[model samples]
Structures are given as structure tokens and as C-alpha cells.
Target: MTISTEQVQTAGRLWQEHRQAPFPDSLRRAEFGGTDVWVLDLYTAGCVLAWLDNDGILDAENGRILQSCIEDLARVIPEVNDPAGAQYCQQLHQLAVLISKNLASTK
Candidate 1:
């Protein structure tokens, strides 16, 4: 799926808005609307990271954040038990894998 320029801008806004907030304390038991919030957040963040990287806007700090997002998703994947949670986890994993490959190629 293509991320529009507006979506990339929104991702940048989201990153700046939340970068300094506390790491999600709720990750250990986070859920909402029958889905894992951490997974959802990571999916969005991962997309933003990829978009930023593609647009030549990703800095080292942002790269670290992206890596952290991937790690966070990996850490929580085993905890997800529901079908919806599993789907989100799978999507996140695929995003992370693709992003990692893309980043590697750009290096």
C-alpha cells in the first residue's frame, strides 16, 4: 500500500507528538476493542519509519525509534493470543521485515 504524502506528514506529526512520552507502560497488558494497542501503534510507527526513510527524512534517532518499535512488536507477539491480535502481530512482523530489508539496502 502506498502512503500518501499527507500520511507521511501525519506520521511525522505523530512521531514528534509522542517521541518523548513515556514508553507504553501498558504494553504488558495493553488491549482495546479486542486488539493489541501496542501492535497497532507499532504498525503505524513502522509505516511512518519506512515512509520517512523512503523520503530521505529518517535520521539516526528516528532509525533507533523504528528499531525499537520493531523490537517492541517482537517482544509482544508471543503474548498475543486472540485471532485479531495474531493478525496484527503478523502484519507488524511483515512490516518490520520489509523495513529492515529496505534500510539495509539503503545503507
Candidate 2:
């Protein structure tokens, strides 16, 4: 199943509890723009979406590895202090995962 961008945005808005390590923290609060939140969500959503869209395009084994790579990349959440970059990094990581998954699930 594919999640729409709008839906993701809503989910992000609803989310209140700040995420912890390996989920996009940040080097500094100012860096991530107040505790690395939105960016993380964006990244996560992107990863999933990308996988769904690209996984199939890649070969079986290659696709799977790609998915795994994306997953790994998205795993590390910057530093708690670096909120400015943290959020963005998280979002970008998510996109990586999304793309990876999409590429790996092809028949």
C-alpha cells in the first residue's frame, strides 16, 4: 500500500511525542529547528514511499539490498543538539528508505 503525501503531513502534525535516537535527533536544537520532528517524519515517509515505488524496478536480490541500505541509512538520527540538521537528515533518510524499498520489490 502507498501512503499519500497529504496523509503523511497530517500524521506529522498529529505527532507530539518527540522521537529519540536513531530516528533523527540533531547536532543542536537550532540546527534541527526545535528538536528534530517534522524532518524525521518526512524522511520516514519518503523511505516507505520510495521503496514502494522503486523496489519493483530493481532485481530481486539487488532490490532487497537496496531496501536494507535505505533502512540502515534512516536508522541513524543525528544528535539531540543538532535539531536543525537532524530533522532534515531524518526526512532525507526517509526518502532514501522509500526509494530503496520501492526498488527492491519488483517481480
lDDT of 2 at 16: 22
Model 2, span 10-107: residue lDDT tens: 43432322233344333323233243344435444444444334423444555555455445434445443456554655555554444553342255
What TM-score fits each model? 0.51, 0.34
Give the 10-residue window scoring lowest on summed lDDT in candidate 1.
Answer: 98-107
- RMSD, candidate 2, Å: 9.5
Candidate number of the best lDDT:
1
Q: Rate the local accuracy (lDDT) of all candidates.
A: 0.56, 0.44
Flag clash pairs in model 1. Answer: none
Predicted model with the maximum TM-score = 1
Model 1 regions more than 4 Å off: 1-36, 39-57, 104-107
* Model 2 stretches with alpha carbons more than 4 Å out: 1-56, 78-80, 100-107
* Residue-by-residue lDDT tens digits, candidate 1, 1-107: 33457655654564565554444454446764454666557555655655565753444555666666676666666776765655555565555444444442232
Error of 2 at 96 (Å): 3.2
